[model samples]
Target: MKPLVSATFLTLASGSIGAQAAEIGATFEKPCPFGDCSAGIAFTFLGETSIQTGFSEADVEFGGISGLDFDQATGRFVALSDDRAERGPARVYELDVDLSAQGLQGVSVRRHISLLDVGDIPFAPQSVDPEALRLGPEGFYWTSEGGGSSQLPPSVRVSFPDGKHLREFALPDGFAPTAEGSSGIHDNLAFESLTMLPSGDVLVALEAALQQDGPKPGLMLGSPARMVQFDVLSGKPKAQYVYMISPVPQAGVDGEKAMNGLSEMLALEDGRILTVERSFAEGAGNTIKIFMVDLSNATDVSHISSLARHEDLIVPARKTEVLDLNGIGLRPDNIEAMAIGRAGDGTEILLLAADNNFSARQKSQFFAFEIVQRLQ
Candidate 1:
């Protein structure tokens, strides 16, 4: 692959809100540093920028962003804040991105919708940790990593544009919180990634291994993360596959491996999928990588409760590396959201957003890339 041209970073700050004084800011520039890229399927780093918005009209709360989705009908971006209403009410924001030949021109907040529960009330604080967002036939589909201390099981739910809950998906027993039984999920590690395929199937990926499956990732070896595919309309499971997670890149606090888990995925028209594997080093920053997964030869291990560590026993989905953000000259942050932009001509755009954790040391960042995939 060719090296990216030299560029400078730009930082812009906009005016504040009325009395609450919400601040909106952003910056854009580029300098791709990927090396020895492979062929067949690849992504060209278009550009990247850091964005911050605190508009009273938009009700934008600068917290960790965990999910992202695009509405082609209205050309707006829908984003989910991982906060469970602690900092503010659980909400989603619609944004408008101005794109030009140079790269991303600017970003503007359009609408902010607060999530509501069955009784038509705002979601109670510390109740649901919303993680993923997608446009569905009914309206917008969202997923939450249920609170572990409260023994709340992770869930997928649908709601109208106004944030009124329509229905919740029935999850498998294995996904219940640890307090439920021995086969449930680990604390803070549940359904973190979600995607809807073109074939009317929704894929939900577990953040880490289940209590009955195996242990979490270690210093050198990785752990197996399970992915479940189900009928979006009926919520009936159709298939399941194992996705191995790489170990943390560096040591963590109190002598533990930092963290490495599946963040998001994009279902392709050809049945295969592109997934993001994110790793965080306590002191080294983040390592975000994209893999193209081939499901043609994947085995459905739904019936098997505990997958053996035998090298030859497990047949996981085949993965091929397509992009790595570490080498792209952009500061690595917690990237939890990924989405595919509307296709134009024969090319498609991939958009990525980072969660800032509402910290002054961190930032809410965004990146864009163009993908060129040929029909095989």
Candidate 2:
């Protein structure tokens, strides 16, 4: 076992985005002492940075970064903003992240692309809530949680690097949002996780249990979340699996606002996945947990319309707790995005981003971790 190390804090000079620089405060820590290391893999905290809340470029706001992915080809990071066109046009920003053996150096915006609809125009306000992003063979693949007020069903779409609409994958009927709430995804709890498998297939997962699947996660009982895998060539769902989400850790101060749900996922080259589950309470801050899930023995529930009806016969995906951020001795914000990147020496690095919700109280925080794998 690795000995516990103390935390180091640093205030890095602001990195320039276009012409303006955003101040960043960073913290560095050693490997998580409470993480599960029996699996021969571990995560060591590299460092973290927080951009100023109101950072902007070209008259567009730079908050609400709900989804993030690194592009090796371009050596840039693509960050999706879930603005819903309220602050500006829905968009994605390309970021340049500097890292080394010491830890994170700085982060800066490189480019901003406005997401366009079929009409080749930016989506109007209250029309889309993009939550997940992945770089694909043809273009960029992203998912929108959909809006209940606008009656927009959750969607998976591909677009050119310039943000031109390409095509959309047809979601299963169970994902459609309804006003009566008889069935379908709960409000603001649709698809929030997306990843492209090594085989070129696409996978998207729900944030929480669907209305028909079961009840939302509570203190004692977890919720059943669904994951749908689609064939990239056909844009059709090929398989679906259930992922049981951890219940809320603590009751909110108000007794009704605390919640926990799957936020994002990163597919490993070996067919496994690392999932991020984030919980937030009214008085307490966020609780972030990372789990490694293996789907090899998981039963496909594509034909099973409602998991609640056939709960007895389903085998949900097997998951093992990997890292719990609470043990790192730092309070985490609303972390909703995860991506894999590379350090200066080619070591694998894990990157995480938090959604500020365009609120002044919250922060646009980014974290980097070195991926350490021990050979047996």
The numbered model that scores best in TM-score is: 2
* Model 2 residue 17 CA deviation in Å: 37
User: lDDT by residue for model 2 over 1-376, one digit each (tens)?
Assistant: 2212222334222121223212122322222222533334455567777887888878888989899998888777889999998888889999887776566776788778988988788888888899999998877899999855567899999899889999899889778978888778888989999998888899999998888899888899899999999999889999999899998988888786889999999987656788999999988889888888878788998888777887467888988666666644446799999998764445556889999998889888888875644222
Candidate 1 colliding pairs: none
- Which 10 residues in a row give candidate 1 its minimum summed lDDT? 21-30
Please list the C-alpha lDDT of all candidates, in the order they appear: 0.72, 0.80
Residue-wise lDDT of candidate 1 within 77-113, one digit each (tens)?
7888898888877888887766555666555666678
- Give the best candidate by lDDT: 2
Model 2 alpha-carbon drift over 4 Å, by segment: 1-39, 254-256, 343-347, 374-376
**How accurate locally is residue 102 in candidate 2, as Cα lDDT from 0 to 100?**
64
| Model 1, runs deviating above 4 Å | 1-39, 53-60, 252-257, 308-312, 342-348
**In candidate 1, how many Å is residue 22 off?**
32
